[model samples]
Target: MHAFVHEGNELIYKNLNDPVIEKGKVIIALRAAGLNHRDLNIPSRRGENSIPLVLGSDGAGVIEQVGEGVKELTIGDEVIINPGLGWEKNSDAPPKGFEILGMPDNGTFAEKIVIDAKQVEKKPDHLNWDEAGVLALPALTGYRTLFTKAQVKKGDTIFIPGAGSGVATYLIQFAKAAGAKVIVTSRSKEKLGKAKEIGADLAIDTHEDWESLLRNETIDIVIDSVGRATFNRSLSVLKKGGKMITFGSTTDDEITINIRQFFYGQYQLFGSTMGSTEEFKEMLDFISKHQIKPVVDHVFPLNNTQAAFDYLRAGKQFGKVAISINR
Candidate 1:
């Protein structure tokens, strides 16, 4: 099998031994894989002694070989891999053993992968191979953020900063489907326009004064991923006691906030990551119910995996960037 691997500070396309099926697992003939910001961080986290690792998180494929004890799935079934591992049911937090796919575990960047059957779900019928490939990670993150953590409800106004991400696009679609009013912010004018076309009721330029433009509106929830760069500004627009859910910190991890102001405002802040298996199922169902399709900005062939990573790192994508494997 050919895979995109990270070894000693470099990413290379190379051949690897095909994964063998294990009990309760299935070998998937990967059709497509998705790129995420996490994929960019994997190479930096590797130590000098670290083994070469396949890097990818989201993927859609067909079950080619189902191992012993796996009964619910069979060969030829089309499915998407749930990147989240260890955490099974819905809970306040993932278990201590929780880890995402890729990194320490070889992931879906290859033509084939073996994953626990429990991690594979039927690909939503409404989605194509590209859409299904990119759907799992971001959609699950957005679902848990909007529905579980923030408990967003109908008629509520939801504010999303960094609107160009895959998760942000999902948040917009999910929030709108739930009957909430959606507002998004993006530095790119083109992204702001795309956000509105998808379902955002309002799109604001990140360069403008956010608090000033939103003074008349009441934000019940703020879904943010920009981290230190936009954290304070995101809070400034939220109504008192509004919920703020964060899944990633693309800008910077460290940020100092005024404790007094935070407490005084009575805001609710929550941290979220890739969701559990149960939430993954719910996310799939939600998208299926709404007939929602993921926004795929570009697709690259398997051999061009490095270029896909470069495109994502440049922040040029409006939504998800996918790798076509079996295609």
Candidate 2:
């Protein structure tokens, strides 16, 4: 099988051995795969050999072979890899030993991959290969961050900082679908317009003082992924006692906050990551029920993966960048 291998600060397409099926695993003939910001960080660890090794965590494919005890799925079934491995159910947090796909284990960058049968869910018929391939990781992250962690409610004024990411884009869609007034921030005016096109109630340019633009309006909920660059301002916009959900820190993770304001104002803070299998199922149902489709900014053929990686690393894409594995 052909795979994009991350070695020495570069991605190389090479012929790698096919994944051997395990007792509870199934071989998937990958049709499509997707990129995340995490992939961008992996290349930086090249000299240290700390890269996820294969570098990918999102994919949609067709089952080509099934292993023992995998009675729920069969060959020829179209499915999406959940990526979040070893965490089966919802809890206060993911249990110890949890891992995501695409590192240590070969991920979807190849034409084939072997994954736990339990982690594969039926792909929605409404989404095409590219859409399905990019759906799982970001959508799950967004869903758990907004609905489970933040507990967003109808008619709530929800503010999401950083509007162009796959997760941030999905947050806007989910919040609006749940009847919340969705506001988003981005430095790119074009991205801000795209956010409004997709249902954001208000879009603000972060290049200016967002507090002034918003008139210091208290937001009911704040879903943030950008860390040090916007964390303080994100908190400042939230209504006192409002919920704030954070999943990623693309900028500096180290942070400082006014302890007195936090205690006296009574803010609810929650940190989230990849979600449970149960939540993945619920996310699928919600998206299908609402007929929501993810925003795919670009799709590149598997062999042209370098260009895709470069595009994502440059932060030029407004939505998910997908790799077309088979077609």
Q: How do all models score by TM-score?
A: 0.98, 0.96
Q: Please, what are the lDDT tens digits per residue for candidate 1 over residues 38-97?
A: 999888778553478999999999999999999899899999999999999999999999
lDDT of 1: 0.93
Query: lDDT per model, in order?
Result: 0.93, 0.89
Best by TM-score: 1
Ten residues in a row with the worst lDDT in model 1? Answer: 43-52
Residue pairs with colliding backbones in model 2 are none
Candidate 2 local lDDT, 1-327, one digit each (tens): 888878765678878778888888899999999999887776664455534256689999999989988989989999999999889988879999998887666778889998888889999999999999999999999999888888888989998889999998899999989999989999999999999999998999887777777765659999888999999999887888999888999899999999999989899999999899999999999999999999999999999888998899899688899999977
Candidate 2 stretches with Cα past 4 Å from truth are 46-52
The clash count for each model shown is 0, 0
